[model samples]
Target chain A: MKARVYVTLKPSVFDPQGKTITDALQSIGYAGVEDVRQGKYFELELATTTPEATRSMAADIADKLLANPVIESYRVEVV
Target chain B: MRFGIVVFPGSNCDHDAYHAAKHVLGQEAELLWHKDRDLKGSDCIILPGGFAHGDYLRTGAIARFSPIMQSVKEFAAAGGPVLGICNGFQVLLEAGFLPGAMLRNRSVRFQCEHVFVRVEQTDTPFTLACTRGQVLKIPIAHGEGNYFAAPGVIEQLERERRVIFRYVNASAEAVESANPNGSIAAIGGICNEERNVVALMPHPERACELALGSSDGLVIFESVIQAIRSGRCAATLRHAQGRPEPSRGASPPAAALVQ
Candidate 1:
């Protein structure tokens, strides 16, 4: 089984890397982009075959290690 | 007083901290390896800065589970004083000894320069040697030193006088340009609620000698030594001890910008 974890800075938190990307986009003549935010993606190999179990375990892993709850939020999906 | 410097595998500043404590300050110091479960009866602990676990996941995420951290946690729980500098500060946050998280620098650049930090609180174990509102010019080298916390928590830290240091200009005002990493409140260092554990972004150990640019950082090491040797309680009870009171009325301008 494979699980995916997505980590992103909360809306209230500032994302400097994302803003730089936005600036790069503007320099390349792109427009109409309201905002850009950067985040991390993690794909995990799990031993569990159950989707429910994998999702719960991935969420727990994300909470404990993949993301810092203070400034980042995380979502998990089992595939 | 015996100072224990925890040396994780990637910790580069452990020797600097050991030298500051031993050669410079004439205090007993030892380096505790990452896998060591014992604190070796150290009166105080210093977490030295480096790319712990190669900073794979997040800065301090992997180092938090190092074998030595359990002992460090117990030591802090027993009211032992601990100072975390730079990457050490990241470790303390991951270990849950300090509040807030380190975000990427707002400029998205690795900043390595001398910056001024105004001492906001002078009564904690780490700042006892510093006078209130005194600015110390120190060098900061990091990309993820921008400290962030929830708005309510930031308010509480300010109210409790836990903000020990704030980035500031020469005039001791925390202006936007003075902020090296866009830390909320321009916070350069902070103490735990009990005041025993402190996490600072600047490298104090590197500044202990005259050749290192500024010796202002020596005061922090001196304060820790004095605190442990004087038989004073490291943890301030309810934070009601005699703290210098100007911070309540003289909140820094950058702090207001975040709110």
Candidate 2:
């Protein structure tokens, strides 16, 4: 089984990198860009074959290790 | 006092901490490898600055799982005095020893310079030697040093006097321009409610010598020694005496924001 995890800063947290990217995009004539928030994506291969089990395991990993609960939130997708 | 400086694989400031403790402060000091489980009966434990675990994933993220951290956690739970500086501060936050998180500097660049930090609370073990509102000059070097937390947490920290340091100007005013990394409320350091664990973003060890352009950092070390000598660190001493451990609980939530 394979899993994908998306980690993003919470809405209340400041995103400096995202802000800079937004500025660069606007400078390049893409003035329509309003807000940009940077995040992390992780793809993992699990030895488990059960999709249900994989999803739970990935979510646990994301909560405990891949994401800091204080500043980040994560979503898990298993396929 | 005996100081134990934990040296993670990528730690670059371990020697600086050791030198500050052993030479500058004239105290017994030892470097404890990250893999070691024993604290060697240290009176104080220091997690110095460096790119621990190569700062992969996130700063201090991977390093928090090192074998020694378990021991560090236990030591702290027993009310031992633990000081985390710079990258060590990030580790403490990740490990849940402290509240909040670090973000990239608002300028989006690595910063390395001496800045003024005003002493906010001197009742804690780490600042007992300094007067409240005294300013110390210390150097900070990091790309991700901005500190953030929820608003409620900030209010609680303020109500309990957990905030210990704030970036400030030469005259000890916490002006906007003086904040180097955009830390909430210009916080440079904070301690748990028990005052046993402290985390600070500045490198006091690097500023302990006059030849290093500042000796102001010595006050912090002196404060710790004074705390120990005066038996103010009753919890840690009680643990050292093999008394029954006190009940432990999670630190209260804290928050801060600079207007």
DockQ category of candidate 2: medium
Candidate 1 versus the native: TM-score?
Answer: 0.91
Candidate 1 lDDT over A1-79, as tens digits, reads 8999999989999899999999999888888766799999999999998999999889989988899999899988788
TM-score of each: 0.91, 0.92
RMSD of each: 9.0, 7.0
lDDT of each: 0.86, 0.87
Q: Compared with the true structure, what per-residue lDDT tens digits does model 2 show for residues B105-192? A: 9999999999999999988778989999999999999998999889998888889988899999999999999999999999899998
| Candidate 1 segments exceeding 4 Å error | B233-259
DockQ of each two-chain model: 0.81, 0.76
Alpha-carbon error at B60 in model 1, in Å? 0.5
lDDT of 1 by residue, B65-107 (tens): 9999998887787677899999999999999999999999988
List candidate 2 segments past 4 Å from native: B238-259
lDDT of 2: 0.87
Report the lDDT tens digits of candidate 2 across residue range A4-67.
9999999989999999999999999999999999999999899888999999999989987999
Docking class of 1: high
- Scoring model 1 with DockQ, what do you get? 0.81
